[model samples]
Each structure stands twice: as structure tokens, then as C-alpha cells.
Target: MAEENKQIAEQLIEAVGGLENIESVAHCATRLRIMVTDKEKIDQGKVEELDKVKGAFYNAGQFQVIFGTGTVNKIHTEIIGLGAPESSSSEQKKDAAQKGNKIQRLLRTFGDIFVPIIPVLVATGLFMGLRGLLTQEEILAIFGMTPADISENFLLYTQVLTDTAFAFLPALIAWSAFRVFGGSPVIGIVLGLMLVNPALPNAYAVGSGDADPLYILGFIPVIGYQGSVLPAFIAGFLGAKLEKWLRERIPEALDLILTPFLTLLIMITAALFVLGPIFSIVETGIMAAMNVVLELPFGLSGLIIGGLHQVIVITGVHHIFNLFEIQLLADDGFNPFNALITAGIAAQGGAALAVAVKTKSKKLKALAFPSSISAFLGITEPAIFGVNLRYIKPFVMGLAGGAAGGFFAALFNLQGNGMAVTVIPGMLLYIYDFLPFVLYILTNVIALSVAFVLTWMFGFNDKMLDEVNQ
Candidate 1:
């Protein structure tokens, strides 16, 4: 075990370029993510060759090394120095002058929810989306021939897929929290599962509204921590402290059973009552802050949204932004106050499309173009992560183009006020359908065209296209 661990530790250190080479260490889902000075300095092939590595994939400015299982605790120890981010100004500056580790934190939470079950979600999402289409037209009923019980096969299967992801979210988070605290996440996962069970009210879909999900913990007013990313975050923070203490004091034989029990009691108690509410309120504040920013200025708003929209995608937290989009539309169908979105789609999508064409790396090109098309079709994730953000030049150019386009869109009062990106099909979805439609379509075309031209002009120097293609 020591030999294997030594090898794993060595591989990790090497992958990140000696222990000193690592600026920061973090993990999410299948990847042991790192922040480094230069990605070129690392040997990609060696990282891939490691027995535990699933693969390494780079996109949207982040490089990731995949580890299938037994990853959380191992990588967790490497970061946070087994417990605590340094309080010194230098350490904070190091963390700050860099990417703020927000990506790392967000990725960890997302991993808790969907990473473990991505294949299932996609397969099931496809099935459910198709089945919904089929059933709405009574296609499925034709085969079964029953009004009351037409065909739940699609619904059943889709629910199975969704339920697994949702129900397991807490447990997954627990594991992550454990790892974050410098302990075995498996036990944390066990306690998280306890909260996620169906028997627990306010466990699933309980975070949004006016109710506290936590009913009680044997009569204490513990809040619900189920289906929540932040709760686990708080729990993990405390759990780590508890784990370090137990590790020193407990005897080896009884430690395994006894330590976990104490961690559970203490962590759960703190998470359910004290920390849960605080995290919940903080999450609400973040959403409020982003919405406030959108109202600031067309140019600034566009720049912020355009630049970070892809970051939102890479972390899979774009859904949080999306909730705001929905609310904005609902509040004012014909509202001009909202930051113009159609232009954002066009600018980002255009930038992605441009990179798709310019890159000689056929694999990246293929992913980029089709993904851009998908973004055009209202799925910005693939385009933002796979294409635009990969090349800094294109991403920045697109943001500039997006800001210009969005400003023009706002000036024109071009409002696609109904559905978001996919509403491309129905221009009437815009309140002032004619002006906004013309402006949106025109700007999207122009910005994207310019984005493509810019990427070809600038990125080719760094792309190493000639060497790679040769």
C-alpha cells in the first residue's frame, strides 16, 4: 500500500511539475485539476500513461488530468496543506492574483451533482427529451392504447436518471466535503446519503423557496442540507478540522469506526443548523449580485457576461445564471431594462465558429464548429468551453464584439424577451420583434464573422498548427 501510494504521490507531483511547480491543487469528478505557470512545461503523455489516469483534456483555459476513483482524499491532502488555506497576505495574494480558485470550488460542487452520473444524465436526457416529443403528439399512446396509463416508459426512465443524480447529490457532496477537510470522503458520503433519502422532507428541491428543508435532528432545529452544494461545502470545512484532531488522538484499531461517528455527529450538527442557513443566504446573495451587475451598463454588462459566461459553463454553474434569465423574462416580457442577450449568443457563438474554421487541429476544429452550432441552437456550454475560451485571443475578441453588439442591440431596444438563445426560431419571442430580430441576427452574423477573422489573424502564431499538422 505504501509503495502504491508513493507511486501515486510521485505521479501527481510529476504531473503538476514537481511539488513546487503546482500553484494550486484541486480535484473534481474524474480530474485532478491544477493551476500551473505554464501548461507546456508539463509532460502530457506521461500524465496520461499513469495507470490511474483516465485521460487528460484541455479546454476553456483549464487543463485536467482524469482519475477514475479513490481520488478525493489523495488530491485533497495535497492542497490546503492537509487543512487551512494560509491566512497570510502573500498566500492570499497568490490565490487572488491568480484565478481565485472559484473554478476549483465550483467544479468540486458540480462533480458532486452530475459528474459521477454524466453518462446516465446524457443518455437519459436524450431519451426523455425524445420521449416527451413523441408523447406530446400521442405517438406513444398509439402503441399502448390507454388514456390513463398511456406510456410512462419515458417518464419512468427519465425520472430514474434524474432521481439518481438528485438523490445522490448530498452523499456525493459529503464525500467531497470529507476530502476537502482532509479525510476519507466515503464516510461523508454515507452521512450525506442519510439526508438525501426520500423520507427526509426538504431534502430534494428544497433549497429554492421560503421553507427551511431541515425539519429536525432528533428534535434539534437542523436545516435540510440535501441536494445542496453549499451545505456540503460548510460541512467539509468543519469535518476537516475534526478529522485532523481524531487522526492524532484516536488509536488505530478503534479510530476507523469511532472517528467517523464523531465526525458525523459534529459535522452534521454544525452543517444542518449553523452553516446551512449561512451558505443558503450567501448563495442567494451571489445570485442577487450577478443580476444587479447585468443592470449596470450595456457595455460593461456585456463584457462581464461575455467573458465569464464560458467560465460559468466550464463549472456547470451556468444553470444558476439561467435562473436569473428566466426571472427577468417573466417580470417583463416587453422589458428594455434587461441586458440584451441575443447579442451575447451571437458574439460568443461567432467567436467559437471563427476558431472552428481557423484551427488546423481537426479534432478541436470539429468540436469547435459543431459546438458553436449548438450554442447557436441555445446550448452555449459546448461552444464556450470547447471553442471560444480555449483561445484567449478569440474569447477576448468575442467579448469586445459582444459588448459592441449588445450595446447596439440595447440602443436599438432589440429585445428577444421571451425564450433565451433557442428562441432564434421565433423572432416574435422578442417584444419588439422586428427591430430586435433584425438587429440580433445582423449583429450575430457580423460579430461572429469578425471573431473568426480575428482568431485566424492572431492565434495561428501560438497554435503550433504547422508543427502539429505536419
Candidate 2:
């Protein structure tokens, strides 16, 4: 197995114009991301045809070859062992930054800032779903109990699990943004904590009219930023910049004391008096706009977003949705976008499954089956780049499936208790109620059936695979 992996690695390096043409190489969960010295020298067709390779694409300045999860790791290790310059994901990202347009770079930055924070959010979402399941009236009745029968302490404990992350979400965002922006992460945490300080009026309380904002200079309204994304992000950016600037100018002897002191003093003042209030309004407006779109008549919004979601994933810019989904969960405690996008994700699996069942070639069948399984399990790169996308019709059929499913999701007013997980594993988010669970299942079924049937009928045949292989 090791020798075979080494041979595959060697073939991959040669396919991409030899080791000398390679600038650096790295791997993510599923792809071997390579930055080459010259794009013209690489043979994409040969790379795609190589043994153990699933598919290949160039995006954000990297030539990414899908090799499944464990397989990609082995190939990457073999590549490094064969004298290729091994690069960290961070270094590869830097190379990517030098290639894409301004908007692409910005979206990638948002991705970097949020990717580390998603696991906590996902766990919290699961906790919330579990709490909802336990507290549902019908579920309780089945167990011969009522909400009142549940222990108050247990309820409080559930709240701790579900609420703490969101209650101090600004801190996490700030800390992450600070790290991304090259600032002191500990300082960012301190700054973020100050934004949600118990001393100030709560932003949610102020919005709900339960508490008035504390006035600064008898005019500027001061409120703690709780459950806010934009405010913390902006504050982190400005704070990091200030800290970096002060570090450069401060004397070495007093750098530690003076840099943080001056940085915090300036940032806290700017954040409370300026950034918080301004960006809070901006954030509210953005959320309001998204809600208006989501509430569009007859599920038009879902149809449009769902059809285009995977197309965006192909561009590698889909991570921007994390910000929107996070904001939705923070403000509304429910994420409808999660329900809408799951259809798109499910359709990818469905389309891949169709191709897997229809293909005759042993090699194509081998790639398609496992790739479809990966898609059903909530990772779609293999199914997408490997199978469905290679056959253009299947990808389009998947889009149609997504549109149909999304329409149902919006029509039924489906909302998830959490975000992150999707497809089969995403069933956890809908277990809160029988009706929601049923609707979630129905939506995914519609998506999967539509994609699978359409692709089986029109998307694949043995001839196409034979031609590609030839």
C-alpha cells in the first residue's frame, strides 16, 4: 500500500509538470492543493486520469485534486517525502490571496475567520436540538410527563449548553478575527469581553424596549453588543490594527504595558462610541433584507438560492454563507437557510448515486459509489468534482432537485435548530418535533428522488465514460 501510494504521488507530481514546476503543496480534508510555478505546464486531463485520483479543478489560484479524505492524506505525505516543498494550509492560502479578485479574497478571509468557530456553534446547535426534543409537549406526553415535571436545574443546565456560545459570540468572533488579522488574540478576547460587559445596557434588552441604552456624553447611546457579528468583527479589525501600530512605535522596555494600555483605551472608546452603534444598525439592516428575501411569496427565494448554492460551492466562495447562517442563529434562534441549503446538498448525493448505479465501467463505478456515500454523509467534493460535475447533465439535474426541495422547505416554513451539519447527519437538527422531522425528511426525499430519477434518465451512460477514458 505504501509503495502504491508513493507511485501515485510520483504520477501526480509528473502530471502537474514535474516537481520543479511545483511551488508548494498542501492538503485539506479531501483535496491535494498545489500551487504551481506555471499553470500552462500542468496537464489537467492527465491529473484527472491518474490512479486513485477522483477529479481536479483550479480555484482561488490552487490546482485542487480530489482524492477522498484518508487517501488524500496519504498521497500528500508521499508527495512531501518525494522532495516536494510541503506547505501549510496557511501558506497555501497566502498564495491563493495573491491570485483572486478583491471580493474572492474578502470572502476567503470571512471563511478563515469563521471556520474555526463553526465546531462550537455546531455543538451548541445539537445541544439546542436535544433540549427542544426533551421539552416538546408531545414527546413528554409519550413518556407520561409534562414540562413542569422536568427538573428546573436540568433546564438551567440545558440553557448553559445552548446559550453560552451565543451570549458571548462577539468574543469568539473577535478572537478569531484578531488571529486572522495578525493581532494579539488574548487582547482581542479582552476587547470582545468589554463589548458585552455586564456594566452596559444589553443590546437585545434595548431592542426589545425592556432596558434603555446608557447615554454617553448625554447623547451617544451605549449598549453591550450581545449576539452580534458585524460589530465584533469591525471592532476586532480596528483593535488589531491599533495594537499592531502601537507595537511598532512603543519602546521595547515599556512595549508590553504601553501597547495594550493605549490600544485598549483607544479601541474601547472607538468601539462603544462609534463602531458598535454604527455597525449594529448595519447588521440589523442586512438581517432585515435577508428576512425579506426569505419571506418572498411562494418560496421564490428558496428556489433561487437553492438552485445556485452548489454553483457557488464550485467557485469555492460558499463559506461566506457561514456568516449569514451564524447571524441568523444569533438573532432569530432558528435558521431557515439551513433547511433551504440541505436540499441542495442532498441533491448532490442523489445525482452522484444515480451515476454510480448507471455507470458500467469498473473504474467509474468505483469512484462514483464512494463519492456518493461521502456526499450523503455531508461532504460533497468527491460527488461533485468527481462524478456529477464531470457529467454536466447530472449537476444540472441536481440543481433542479434543489429548486424543488427548496420550494417545499420554504412552503412548509422549515427551520433548523442548528447549522453546519446537513443531509443524513443533519436529521439531528429536526428531531425537536414530529412535524418538523417529517417535513425535513420529505424535503430531502423530494430533492434526492428528483435528482436521482432525472440523472438516471438523462444524465449518464457508458458511452460518455468510455469516451473520457479513451
Candidate 3:
């Protein structure tokens, strides 16, 4: 197996125009992310056809070859062993900035800032779902206890599990943004904490009219930035930039003390008095616009977003949705977008499964089956690029399936207790409510069935496979 992996690694290096052409290489979850000096020299078709390679695509100025999860780690190790330059984070970011267009780079930055924070949110979401399920009136009735019978301490414990992340979400975002933008993370955390300081009016309370905003200069309104994304992100960016600039100018002896002191003083004043109020309004407007779309008559919103979701994924800019979804969860405490997108994800898996079942070639079947499973498990790139997009029609069928399921999702007013997980594993999010859980399952079934049936009937055949193989 080691020798075979080494051979595949050698082939990959050669396929990408030899080791000299590779500027740096890295892997993330499922793909071998390579930065090459010359795109024209690399043979994309050969890269996709290499052993254990599911598919390959160029996005954000990187040639990413999907090898699935465990397989990718092995292949990456083999590549590095063969003397390809392993990318440092700084080198990768530099390459991304130089290679990608403005929109791609912006989206990548958002991804970098949010990806590390997702696991915390996912765990909190699961905690929320579990707590919701356990505390339902029906569940309580089974135990011959009412809501009043439950211990207040236990409920408080559940709240700790579910609410802490969101309550201090600004801190997490700022910390992540600081790291991404090259600032002292500890300083970022301090600055973020100042935004949500107990001294200020709570943001949610101020919005709900339960608490009035404190007046700065008797004109400007100020409030804590709990559960906020944009303001925190912007503040983190500005703070990081300011910190870097100050570090360059400040004397080495005073750098540690003076830089942070000046940064916090200037940024906190700017954040509370200027950036906070301005961006908070902007963020609210964006949230309101999203709500309007989600509330569109007859599930049209779902149909549009669901159908186009996977197409967006193909561009590698789908990370942009992280902001929208996170905002939905923070502002509304429920995420309808999660329900809408799951249908799109499920359809990809279904379409891939159809191709796997129908393909005659052993090689194609081998790629399609695991790719389908990977999609069902909440990652879709393998199924998408490896099988569905390669066929063209399967991808379209999947889109149709997504539209159908999304229609049902919106029509039924389906909402998830959290975000992040999707498809089969996403079942955890719906378990909080029995009816919603059933409807969520039904939505996925409709999506999977529509894509599978459509692909089986018209999207694929052995003839097309034979032609491609030839």
C-alpha cells in the first residue's frame, strides 16, 4: 500500500507539470490543495484520473484534487515525502491573495475567520437540540412531570451548554478574525470583551425595547455587541491592522504594553462610538432582507436558493453563506436556511448514487459509490465533481430535486435548531421536534428520490460512460 501510494504521488507530481511547477501543496479534509506556478502546464484531466483521485478543480487560485478524507491524508504525506514543498499558512494565504480575484479572496477570508468557530457552534447546536428534545411537554408527560417539575438548576445547566457561545460570540469572531488578519489574539479577545462589557446595555435587550441604549455625548447610542458578527469582524480587522502598524512604530521596550493599551483605547472607542452603530444597522438591514426572502410566498425563496446552492458550491464561494446562516441563528434563534440547503446537499448524494448503481465500468462505480456516501455524510465535493458534474445531466437532475425539496421545506415552514451539519447526520438538528423531524426527513427523501429517479431515467447511461472512458 505504501509503495502504491508513493507511485500515485509520483504520478500526481508529474501530472501537475513536475515538482518544480508546484509552489506549495496542502490538504484540507478531502482535497490536496496545490498552488502551482503555471496553470497551463498542469494536466487537469490526468490529475483527475490519477489513482485514488476522485476529481480535480481550480478555485481561489488553487488546483484542488479530491481524494476523499483518509485517502487524502495518505496521498498528501506521500507527496510531501516525494519532496514537494509543504505550504505554510502564510505562504498559502499569500498565494491565495495573489491568485484569486477580489471576490474569491474576500470569500476565502470570511471562510478562514469562520471555519475554526464552526465546531463550537455545531456542538452548541447539538446541545440545544438535545435539550429541546428532552424538555418537550410530550417527553415530560412520559415522566409524569411538567415544566414546573424540572429543576431550575438543570435548566440553567442546559442554558450554559447552549447559550455561552452565542452570548460571547463577538469574542470568538474577533479572536478568529484577529488570527486571520495577523493580530495578537489575546488583545482581540480583550477588545471583543469590551464590546460586550456588562457596563453597556445588552444588544438584544436594546433591540427588544427591554433596555435602553446608553448615550455617549448625549446623542450617540451605545450598546453591547453580543451575538453580533459584522461589527465584531470589522473591529477585529481594524484592531489587527492598527496593532501591526503600532508595533512597527512603537519602541521595542514599550511595544508589549503600549501597543495593546493604545489599540484597545482607540478601537473600543471607534467600535462603540462609530463602527458599531453603523455596521449594526447595516447588519440588521441585511438580516431583514434575508427574512423577507425566506418569507416569500409559496416557497419561492426556497426553490430559488435551494436550486442554486450547489451551483454556488462549485464556485468555492459557498463559505459566504456561513455569514448569513450564523446571522440567522443569532438574530432569530432558528435557521431556516439549514433546512433549505440540506435538500440541495441530499440531492447531490442521490444523483451520485444513481450513477454508481447504473455505471458498468468498475472504475467509475468504485469512484461513484464512496463519493455518494461522502455526500450523504455532509460533504458533497466528491460526489459533485467526481461523478455528478462529470455527467452534467446528473447535476441538473440534482438541482431539480433540490428545488422540489426546498419547496416542501419552505411550505412546511421547516427550521433547524442549529446549523453546520446536513443531510443524514443533520437529522440531529431536527430531533428537537417530532413533526419537524418527520418533515425534515420527508424533504430529504423527496430530494434524494427525485434526483435518483430522474438521473436513472434520463441523466445517465452506460453509453455516456463508455464514451467518457474511451
| Top model number, lDDT | 3
| lDDT by residue (tens digit), candidate 3, 341-449 | 9999999999999999998888889999999999889899999999999989999999999999999999998999788899888999988889989999999999999
For residues 1-470, write the lDDT of model 2, one tens digit per residue: 99999999999999899999999999999999999988888899999988888889888789999999899999999999999999999889988899988998999999999999999999988998899899999889999999999999999999999999998999999999899999999999999999999999987898899999988899998999889999999999888998899889999999989998998899889999999989988998998998898998898977987777999989888999898999999886899998999999889889999988887778888988898888877888898998888878889999998888999999988999889899898988888788988999999999889999999998878778766666
Q: What's the distance in Å from true for residue 358, model 3?
A: 1.1
lDDT of each: 0.54, 0.90, 0.91
Record all residue pairs in model 2 with backbone atoms less than 3 Å apart, i.e. clashing.
none
Runs of candidate 3 with Cα error greater than 4 angstroms are: 141-145
Specify the poorest-scoring 10-residue window by lDDT in model 2: 461-470
Error of 2 at 147 (Å): 1.7
Q: Pick out the ten consecutive residues of candidate 1 with the lowest summed lDDT.
A: 84-93
Q: In model 2, how large is the Cα lDDT of residue 309?
A: 91
Give candidate 1's TM-score.
Answer: 0.50
TM-score of each: 0.50, 0.97, 0.98
